[model samples]
Target chain A: MAIKVAILGYGTVGEGVYKGIQNHQEQLIEKLGDAVEVAGILVRDPLKKRDVQPGTFITTRFEEILAIPGLHAVFEAIVGKEPGYTYLSQCIEKGCHVITANKVLFAKYGNELLKKSKQHGVHIGYEATTAGAVPIIRTLQELLKVNRVTRIQGILNGTSNFILTEMRANRLSFGEALKLAQDNGYAEANPENDVEGKDAACKLKILCQLAFGCTPDWEEVEVEGIAAITSGEVQKAEAEGFRYKHIADIRAEGGKLKASVKPIAVSSAHPLFSVEGVDNAITLETSLAGNLTLQGAGAGKFPTASAMLEDFSAILEKSLRTKIHLLSARVPV
Target chain B: MAIKVAILGYGTVGEGVYKGIQNHQEQLIEKLGDAVEVAGILVRDPLKKRDVQPGTFITTRFEEILAIPGLHAVFEAIVGKEPGYTYLSQCIEKGCHVITANKVLFAKYGNELLKKSKQHGVHIGYEATTAGAVPIIRTLQELLKVNRVTRIQGILNGTSNFILTEMRANRLSFGEALKLAQDNGYAEANPENDVEGKDAACKLKILCQLAFGCTPDWEEVEVEGIAAITSGEVQKAEAEGFRYKHIADIRAEGGKLKASVKPIAVSSAHPLFSVEGVDNAITLETSLAGNLTLQGAGAGKFPTASAMLEDFSAILEKSLRTKIHLLSARVPV
Candidate 1:
């Protein structure tokens, strides 16, 4: 039987998820041992033109998608905490697995959703929650099993990093860099979230949960944006043998999980210093493995969708019986 | 009932695995829902003075370790192909999950062992067979499900990278840098495998299997050692705005897998250029996620052990029941 799934929201991530499944359907089926069919997509307007398959069901109501017979999972890409949280909660309650790239919603309700998903006997995959396409989430899940995370420093926001790179590379002013980033489709219309470090902090929050298994007080987490970093400062830092990188630093101090997102001058010896453009890099200090760094695209249609699909593949792997079973199970027991 | 496991070979990786399990006992148990105990150690000399726990069993015979009742898994840290392959084969036939860091053995007999292990109803984990502690294997397993990898470039050998970095940074000759690397415990006494790029090629061969799902013929792989690199060339490359790095370049051409490990002059803008010292990095060009680079300690006692342990943890997670049982299973069936 086909593994029925749905897409929640019709934005970039949602569309990428759709295309990824459609394009990689054969590979997915080969790995999953079953065909995955997108039963429906929950979007704001069903009438709005989208790059969707003709046979795909598009609707504004979450209930309509939820009512799809034998729906196995939902990929939530909705913008906010509201409908995403409610829809995912309902999906879990109805016994459907969920995967999301929404850091804001996940950062706020991750612990609760994780608990709820556990309660419902379904998996909640948030690989797209941080460092898109870097594979940090699954890496952390594996490493943190037997290792204690000492420190996590991340360049989580691609927009901020892109702006900072432009400012330093071309001597562009903050306004010019931000405008260029927006023109390049790297930044959103209201750039406060990207420029003000909220996006990085949200990603950092999600990371802290996976790495340290501790959630910090949302209000206590210090956040500072890259908008204050001027061209003169960028040049001065360059002259002083450093680059201004917007870093989300999370570490445990005296048994308390503390996090801060701010612009920091990084030297050439540092890992994040080389992570240029819209690339996101995370340097993790671990108990067993020592220092490790992962760098990749932080945001994009295909990148973010790749993470969600990874989660989907993981879910499928867990649900499916071991493929090597013929050799093992053939021996009469 | 504790999860019973064994360590074959008392080398750096084996000793590290032993100590890692002992140190992270609580964390492992918490995550796995059961305690894990090292049942035996397969070593050449049981009388050898090692940092082994007092009650742990030490034996030179693989059969002795295999005889331990209820042995769930065996960590094969043994070097070379003979005993490692033969012993792992026996372990699999007996229904014991095997995790190994032996790239040479895995590169040679991995397909056979994997096939045999599946037939015997066990898992063969070789996370440490490639880039140690970089989490590339699991990451590729997730990403490769729905993505086609175009190219894989890696600084796979840390000793070669360290030698190159020393040659450039201190203006040392290849001989001097290799000596320095050996002194710093980065290069082995036989440095042939490391400096000659065999180690990196061995690792690259393994990575090719995971990323492209095809094994290249050994003779067809173009292998080049870093020993011929002169300090003058290194300095000249530096002057020309590039740094020479030992890279394992693997790509699919016309549906055939080709791999080469050689030192190439990489610019500052490149991901592998910034990777220095006893660190390994891999840049994978994915059809969906674009280019993603992962860098970490490729070889070390703790680092390599961490990879094996991560594989062990993954095995345990698959074997054990889900933790959130009350939430899902409590409903009326």
Candidate 2:
């Protein structure tokens, strides 16, 4: 049986997923025991004539993709909340499994979609929404099954991390670093989400939900980006045998969840201190497992798509099973 | 429904598994939706009174444990091969799921046991075999499904890592560090496996089996211990702003497998440079996900048992499923 899935956007991640599946077709089939095809792709401009496999369905209409016969899953790679939220909600309502890379949608509406997916008896995998393909989210889900996590701290924003690395290594000012990051396609034109710490907060919220089963009001978490940091501070920290890192720190202390994203001074002994460039790393302090840290690319086309493909494999395995169980209220299960 | 399991040893890892399961009984039930019990424990000296819950079964004979009616799973925490391998083989032959913390047995006979378990339609979880409680094996299984991992480098042996860290931080000689480690119970009296790099080789081979589906012959992989590393070399490396780390490296190049365990000098820019003491870390460089690193307490009573508990939960979930599929030739699925 050939598994059929749809792509909601033909952007970087969407293209990457398509190409990754094509590249690893043999490996995927070997693991899945069946072929998988991207049945339809919902792009903003279907007539744009992008490179796609022959007979690949491309449409601008969500209804057309939804109407595609035997579409078992939907991949949401579009950004922001409005259309993505509407599209994913409708997909879940239609009992379609979903894999998403939209962090904003997840941070704002994850709880709702998680419940909705459970209610509809479908899976929702958002592994790409947080730390690209680090598998932090899945690991957290595994840990939460048998252990209590005390704290989770990470470098969740790649743009900010890249800018920080540039500022430290090249002695560039914040503006210069931001401009360089933008030129390298690592940051957006406005870059508010990445630079103002909103991006990290979104990822942190998603991680908190997985690790602690608690999600903070996005607006309530304290967030301070690398905007206020100076090259002098970076140099001074280096001289003092410390490194300046933009860290997203969340801890459960006295039964309270406290989260903050800010530029913090970390010593040489700190794990996050060495994670430079567009990389992200997460440290999980748990009761039984002790402290476990996972580091990888925080965001990228290939990495994000790799994460989506992981979700696709999981969904395929579940669907192939003779029976499926809604084990918990959680959607990913 | 209730799940019945047995423990094959009453050592540190065995005791930790027993207590951890007892401690997290509610959590386990919530995740599994069924009560799971350690129905019997097979120890060498059952008459030597030890701390145990009231009504817990203790026996010196393996036959007694195997005879316990409806024993669904067996946990092998006993050291080395022989009886452990025989017990596991018998357990699988009897269609019982098995979870093992025995790395030597896994490194020696993992392929045989994996095939046997799959043929018998049972699971064999050895999460506690390599890199205790870090979830590396599970994460690798997840990654192998979607990504092409090119390289794996790890700090796998905690005793050697502890010695190296002590030699650097406390300026201790190799012998002094070994004595301190033995005094602190970090190293066994005959610490040849850990200090001679054989333990790490075993772990590396297991990881290779999971990550690459290629198990190198245990003796074929190059082995280099930290015994040859002196305090002078550690100081020189530190002076040059580098750290001497015992790294277990395995890479698939040109369609061939190359593996070695050696003490390597890593610059501060490297992720492994910051991993000190008994903490172990593995970095997987993949085609899609870039470099993914996982760091944690590699070996500890609680951590090893926590890894076992993870396997326990997985087996419970698998057993609860209505149908089981030997999806891949791989048994871990």
Candidate 3:
């Protein structure tokens, strides 16, 4: 049985997903024991020449995907709200397992989407929505099932980490570093989400949900961007034998969850101090596992897409079974 | 259906696995949909009053586990080669899924054991053999299935990392740090295996097998312990805007694998440079994902046991269908 997958969006991550799936087709088929084929691609501009190889069935119309017969799964790589979120909801409703790299959707409407996914008996995996390549969500949901989670502290945003690392190394100002990040394609043109901690906050919400089973109120999360921290502060922290890192922290206490995304002074003693420049590190403290840390690329074309591939593989595994109880519940704010 | 499991050694990791299994019983049953019960425990002295819960059977005989009718899997946490390796081989031959935290066994006899395991139709998992809480084995096995790994470098040993961390922070010599590590239960009184890079080398060999499909020749691997690195070198590295880290480097070039355990001068720009103290970090450079780094406690009772539980859950999941394939093959030394 060949699993037919349709990709929604033809952006960087979307293209990476396509290219990666093509590059490892034989190996993936061997692992899957069933062939996986990309049947259709829903892109903004279907006629645009992509650098990488994309299959023939490309379309600008979103409905073309929903109408495509035998599409077992949908890979949503579209950014922001509107059509991406709306289309994903419809995909789950139409009995398609969804793998998304959209943090904004998961952060805002994860509970709703999860509920719908369960009702439709489909899975909504957002592993790429948080940390690009790291399997933090799976680690918490599966591996740490037998452990009680205490806290999650992480350097979740790579752009901010890059800027901070540049400041620590080249003494570059925030603006200059931001420009460099933009040039390197690490930061968006506006760069508000990555720099202002919105991106990290969205990831923090997902982490809180997975680790504590509580969806944190995004607005309530105290966020401090790296824009405020100066080169002098970086030098001062260095002199004081500390490193400044933008950290997202979530802790569960007395059945209540508290989460924050802010810059913290990590000494030579802490693990996060060692994570520099566009790398994300997550420290999870569990009763059984003690303190476990996972670090990787927070965001990159192939890294983010690679995470989606993991989710895709997982969906294929679960879809082979007759029944899958996808958790969907309304988490109160 | 319930899966019956046996513990081969009632040591620190074994005890932790026992306690974690009992503590997370509800969650495990919920996630796996199978109740895992400890059927037997192998111990040196059956009469030794251990702090195990009542109702668990204890035995000194190795054949007892193999004879158990419902035994589906075995957890081997026993240290050293004497009976641990021999007993594990027996269990695999009897068609029992084996999960071991013994790096030495895997490093030396992994190829032989894996071949036997494949013939018996059982899976062999040693996620705990590397970084205890870190999911490097599974990450490489599952997540990077489609991607070709280029380079693997990290601080693979916790005891050595602790000693180096102490040496840098306290400005203590290597000997003094080793003494402190011993007193703090971080290192053994005879810490030659850890301090001499043998433990890390063993772990590196297993990782090489997974990453490159070639078993690293332990004799061919260049080993450099922290015994020679002085506090002066640590200070010098720090002054030169770098950090001295004991790194395990493995690279595959032109179908040839080169591996070494040595002290490397890591600049502030390197992700591993910030890993301090007893923390361990592994960086994998892949064709698709670029550089992905994971940091965590490389070894500890709870962390290592956590890896075992993960293996246990994975085995239970696979046992549902009784579909197990031996994926390890003997490579020429």
Kindly report which residue pairs in candidate 2 clash with one another. Answer: none
Q: Which pairs, if any, clash in model 1?
A: A327-B119
For model 2, the DockQ equals 0.44
lDDT of 1 by residue, A95-129 (tens): 99999998989999999999999898898989898
Per-residue lDDT of B323 in model 2: 37
For candidate 1, the per-residue lDDT at A195 reads 98
State the lDDT of candidate 2 residue by residue for A135-206, as single tens digits. 888887754478878889899998999998888888999999999999999998899989888899889988
lDDT per residue as tens, model 3, B1-333: 677889988888899888888888887887677788989999988888888778888999888778999688899998887687899888998889999999888888888998998899888888889988887888887667667789999889888988888887788899999999898888987999888888888888889888888855667779988788889999888788887888999998777788899888888667687677776779899877678887777777788888888877876676553331211111111
- Candidate number with greatest DockQ: 1
Cα misplacement distance, residue B304 of candidate 1 (Å): 1.0
The per-residue C-alpha lDDT of model 3 at residue B128 equals 89
Please write out the lDDT profile of model 3 over residues A194-299, one tens digit for every residue. 8888899889888887777776666666888888998899989988989899999988778777888898988866767778888888988887667777888888
Ranked by DockQ, the better of candidates 1 and 3 is 1
TM-score of 3: 0.89
- Name model 3 segments beyond 4 Å from true: A1-3, A33-37, A52-55, A217-219, A230-234, A320-333, B1-3, B33-36, B119-121, B216-218, B230-232, B321-333
Our model 1 lands, by Cα RMSD against the true structure, at: 3.2
User: Residues B88-142, candidate 2, lDDT per residue (tens digit)?
Assistant: 9999989899999999999889999999999998999998999997888888775
